[model samples]
Target: MISSYSEYKSYLEQDRIALGVRNDHFSSKIKDFLFPNYIWRFEQTLRKLEYYYNCKNSFWSKPTYYYLKYKFRKISIKLGFSIPINVFGPGLAIVHYGTIVVNTNARIGKNCRIHACTNIGASGGTSHAPQIGDNVYIAPGAKIYGKINVANNCAIGANAVVNKSFEETGILIAGNPAKKIKEIDIKKIIKHI
Candidate 1:
């Protein structure tokens, strides 16, 4: 959620750093554009549209926001991501571009490194989605749903189905009903966060 220009810039910078983009300049940007890390492009458009929609009410903002929203939808469809705006905080790292579906109601905190085939959604089409904390690592093929609250610095392993909440932080949760496997140093896993 970008409410101001400075906040938008800061969030963009944090997102770049989270994605391991070291430099920001004309040349580097041109290179990235040419090579096209689609995820970066998606995030850039997402931030821009969010900023325009949230902060501005001028005439130009409306058309620009709609156009960017169209572009954002195209990119997301191409990347197989269904993440909605304002759902994720700053420093979100999507590790791959495949089958990452998040509910519109889910609220994930900053510094979340989520892998492909992960679904953070509500159950039975209800609005009871998960509220995940900061610096969490959601591994590939994980399915976390319902009205659960995952603590900060938590790691959800691959293919784990988490339906319940885990209040303890700095723990690794795995297995089909997802339990605390062990306590881990989250920094070791989410290095960018």
Candidate 2:
């Protein structure tokens, strides 16, 4: 929860700097207090949109879909920009925004970076959800399902489907059914960062 528009403005500035983007267009102080609420509403609208597009029809009904669709459409008209729902634990980061779904039951650890078009959800209609460890990097279009445990310091490659538990550290997993490809140098990643 961002407390105020000023704080959100500052955060946006910081994010732009972190992303190496020029921040000449934004203001440090927000004159309008309603701006934060508008942004939050926009994010919720985009979340509902992403949920509608990605979720299975069996997972949600027609009435619910139409209701959410109408709600989001209203919010979109009000906010004037589409925002994405961004869930994060302590020290977690999402690089790109849009088409990211994380189950409510899923437990994500600290220092994790997730890209766009990723889905983390439960499998087999079970209550149990994924427990992702620290320092994990989940790439774009990846899906992690079931009550699987992804180990620390691991990288899940683009479009990989992870259905089983992984305990290895500093390894890259890729494929339809994900498997370890090779040992990676975590230090190199830090250097680039």
Candidate 3:
């Protein structure tokens, strides 16, 4: 949980590092911070920051909390990412901004890169959401639903609807109710990313 200002700063730095912006000099960092695709991630971080600020019992908390919530809501509408503050891990990358959504109960791991039009959400009578793993890549229009567990280093191809668990790591899953397409070596590919 992002319960402090230090935690918020760390998450921002983690996002920058995941995006390969290690240096983060003033101009470059600010440019990339507001870059269209990347802005959703920053907004998500802001939501978490707002959550922490609201937890404090100070006189200043009200104004700050409301301001951050207003900003978060405004940006969320613009970006179309309906995800909550708690679900994503530190190094999330929203590669594109169009129509992406995640259930608040969903838990995504670190360094996951999700593209446009993806949905990580609930399904059927189940009250739970998908649990995605570290360094996973979700392509455009992919849908991961229910209490499914997607293991680390896996990739969900475009338009795949994942409904069940794939506990085995390092494979490609794609289909209507997604199945393992083939074994994949994400470590080699992630080096370039």
Candidate 4:
């Protein structure tokens, strides 16, 4: 359970390190703290939150869902301006604190790391969402738009703009219009981690 902003920040830092990003700009202590209940209930409520945040096209019949999600949103807005997507499997690990926008249509996989200033959205009028695979590491300021499929074990470099489909694994993608930089040795990164 995250008790304070510092704890949240620490989690983000650990996630970044695990993703092999050598940086340390995510540290900040929490002062004038409020919302103690959120700290206690975060872990318990996380699963349900992820469900609601992910099922964009589905509607729930239960009243409890609405109440709990409403309360959670209120607390989240008060604590910080984070709108966490209801992603499946452990939720998304935010590596930095900033205005990050993830579209409701976008589908992300488990254990994905999203840095600050990243925008994951759809193209003009297209309902087909971006299907992202597991263990993908997206760098800060990257913009991924359209109904692109990013395969598992891929690293999206900083400020890259990805709008195409990639089927290859263990590659580094970079540039305004992202292209494969080189095939990474996933074993090396795993060993380093």
Candidate 5:
């Protein structure tokens, strides 16, 4: 979990930079921050607010935390994202935000991109959840469960059900019970973005 304001700010910048937005034109940035396809601005704000709430200190006002928390709850209900407080890592990119549920135990890494209708949780009454690595892209309708360790630079294709672990990086996992389709150069794909 993020403990400092600087770290949270860094995550906000990373999330924006991932979407091709630069630190220019304050008006446009504000507009984008207010409205986007995935409402990343709202999600990041909620995450940061929760971080501040957990590590309460003099830096942030109590009233501010309360207000943000209230708004966060409303957004969660409206967006159908039942993400628990402080579970997600920084730079989490929500490609679309509807019917997305991530267990509080799940630990996702930096620059992780998530799509709509995705579920990342546990199964068989096991409390342990998935630990996804950096720069991983989860397509729409993907269901990832169990104590899986998804590697960095990987892609979980649409509607793929990831039941096991895949530590190997830069591979595309697809199908119902997900399997390695092929090794992809995600770095190259990211560059063209």
Candidate 6:
């Protein structure tokens, strides 16, 4: 939720830091553009759209909001991402440009480093979805669903299918049904965040 410009900027900066990007203005504008990271661009449009949506009374807010919304949709489609606005907190890092579909009702906390081919969605055609905690790392090809709650500083192993709640923090969960593999230091998994 970006209610103000300062908070929006802070969220964007945190997202950049989570993505291991240089925070300098020149680096953000010149370096990122020259390379063209679609994931980063999607995050930027997402943040800007959220900001404009919150502050809708500005003279240029409506047009800017529509433009950002269009751009966001385009990038999301290209990257195969179906993430909704305000679902993820600050410090969101997408690992790759691939299939990463999230349920609209899912609420993920801060510093979530999610890889591609991951799906955080609802089950049984219901709206109930996983509520993930902060500093969580979702590895590639992970499928987490249901109305489960994952604790903070957790790591979901690659290709893991999580269906139950892992309430204990600082642990690694994996497998088809998803079991707690072991207690781990999340910092080792996500060094930048």
Tens digit of per-residue lDDT, candidate 3, span 105-150: 8998877888889888999867899888888888899988998899
TM-score of 4: 0.65
Distance from true position, residue 85, model 6, in Å? 0.4
Q: How many residue pairs clash in each candidate?
A: 0, 0, 0, 2, 0, 0
Q: Order of all candidates by lDDT, from best down to worst?
A: 1, 6, 5, 3, 2, 4
- lDDT, candidate 4, 1-193, per-residue tens: 2334454455444444444443334331132133233332432354454444434234553466677688777755544424454442233455544656667777777567667778888899887667888778788888888989999878889999999988898898889799999998644533323
What's model 3's TM-score? 0.84
Give candidate 1 regions above 4 Å deviation.
Answer: 24-27
Instruction: List, residue by residue over 147-170, the lDDT tens digit for candidate 2.
Output: 899887788999999999999888
Expressed as tens digits, the lDDT of each residue in 50-151 for candidate 1 is 888788889967888889989999999999998888888999888888999999899999999999999999998789999999999999999999999999
Ranked by lDDT, the better of candidates 4 and 6 is 6
Q: What are the RMSD figures for all models against the true structure?
A: 1.4, 9.7, 2.9, 8.4, 2.6, 1.7
TM-score of each: 0.95, 0.58, 0.84, 0.65, 0.87, 0.94
Question: Residue 16: error of model 6 in Å?
Answer: 0.8
Off by over 4 Å in 4: 1-46, 51-63, 75-88, 186-193
Candidate 5 achieves a global lDDT of 0.80
Instruction: List clashing residue pairs in candidate 3.
Output: none
Q: Write the per-residue lDDT of candidate 5 for residues 55-158, one digit (tens) a residue.
A: 67665578788888888888888888888777666666676658899898998887777888999999999999999988788899999999889999999999
Q: Whole-model Cα lDDT per candidate?
A: 0.92, 0.63, 0.77, 0.63, 0.80, 0.91
Candidate 4 vs 5: which has more TM-score: 5
Worst 10 residues of 4 by lDDT: 26-35
Candidate with the greatest TM-score versus the true structure: 1
